[model samples]
Target: MNQTQKIQNPETNVPKTPQMNERDFVNDQLTTEKYMTASYNIALNEASNQNLYQDLATIFKETQDCQRNLYNLMFKNGWYALEQAEKQKIDQTYQQFTGYKTQLPYNVQ
Candidate 1:
C-alpha cells in the first residue's frame, strides 16, 4: 500500500490519514516541548524563589529528556534528517565565537 500518498476526504476534501496524523501530532508535540524547555530556562533564570527555581529546573531536565527521546524516535523512523556540518565550517564557527571573547572587556568564566 502507498502509505506515503495522501488521499482527500470526499465530504470535506481534507487530506489526511492515521499515519500522517500521528506523525503531525508527534511533530507538534516535539515543537511544543522545545518551546516549553526554552521558556522554562528563561523562567528559571528570572525566578526569585528557591522552591520555584528547583521545580522549574526539574521540569526542564524532564522536558529535555523527552525532547531527546522524540528526536531519537523520529530519526530511527526516518521522519527526521539531520545533516552533518563540515569540520572546516565547525572550526570556522568556533574560531569566530572564540574571537568575540577578546572583543569583550568582561572575561567569561
Candidate 2:
C-alpha cells in the first residue's frame, strides 16, 4: 500500500499569469484564517472580562470553522496537497500520547 497517498480532487483550471488567480485568492484567505485563529487563541487565553471572553470564544469558533471550510474547499479543488500518514507512524504517535496520558490529573485507563 502506498503510504504517501495524496487526497485531492481534480484541480480546477486557473489562469497562469502575474495577476492573482482563484487558487491564489483562496490560499491567501486560508493563510489569513490561520493567523486569525492564532491571534484569537492568544486573546482567548489573555481575556479577563467574562463577557468579552465569551464573545471572543464564539467568534473564534466561527473563525476556526470558516478556516476549516476554506481548507476543505481548497483540498476539494486540489489546491492543497496532503500526504496520508502511515498506519505504523500513527499507531506510534497514539501509543506515545497514551503513555503521556498518565501525567493527567485523572486516570484515563
Candidate 3:
C-alpha cells in the first residue's frame, strides 16, 4: 500500500500517542534535573549537619549522573546537537582567565 493509504486507513495498528513524544518526555526530565540539581545544591549549602550534607551530596551526584545519561541518549537520538568550539576560541578563553592569576595577593613564584 502507498504511504497515504496506510495513514488514511482507520484500522491501522499505529499506537495512539499523547501530546508529547519520547523526545519531549526526555527533554522534560532534563529540565527537571536542572531544577533538582539546583535545589540539592541549595539544600546542601544550608545543611548544618555533616551527615545531612553528605546525604544530599550523594543524591546530587546521582542526579548529575542521570542528567548526563539523558543528555547522551538524546545526543545519540539526534534530539540534541552540540557544536564544537574552535581551538583558537578555547585558547583565547584560557589566556583571558590566566591573565587574572597575577592579580592575586600571592605570587606564584
In model 2, which residue pairs have backbone atoms overlapping below 3 Å?
none
Candidate 2 residues 9-90, lDDT tens each? 8898899999999999999999999999999999999999999999999999999999999999998898888788999889
Full-model lDDT for every candidate: 0.77, 0.94, 0.78
lDDT by residue (30-90, candidate 3, tens digit) is 9899899999999998999999999999999999899889977777666676565666777
Ranking by TM-score: 2, 3, 1
Better of 1 and 2 by TM-score: 2
Which stretches of model 1 miss by more than 4 angstroms?
1-20, 106-109
TM-score of each: 0.74, 0.90, 0.76
Candidate 2, superposed: residue stretches over 4 Å from native: 1-3
Q: Which has the better TM-score: candidate 1, or candidate 3?
A: 3
| Reference-based lDDT, residue 16, model 3 | 47
| Candidates ranked, most accurate by lDDT first | 2, 3, 1
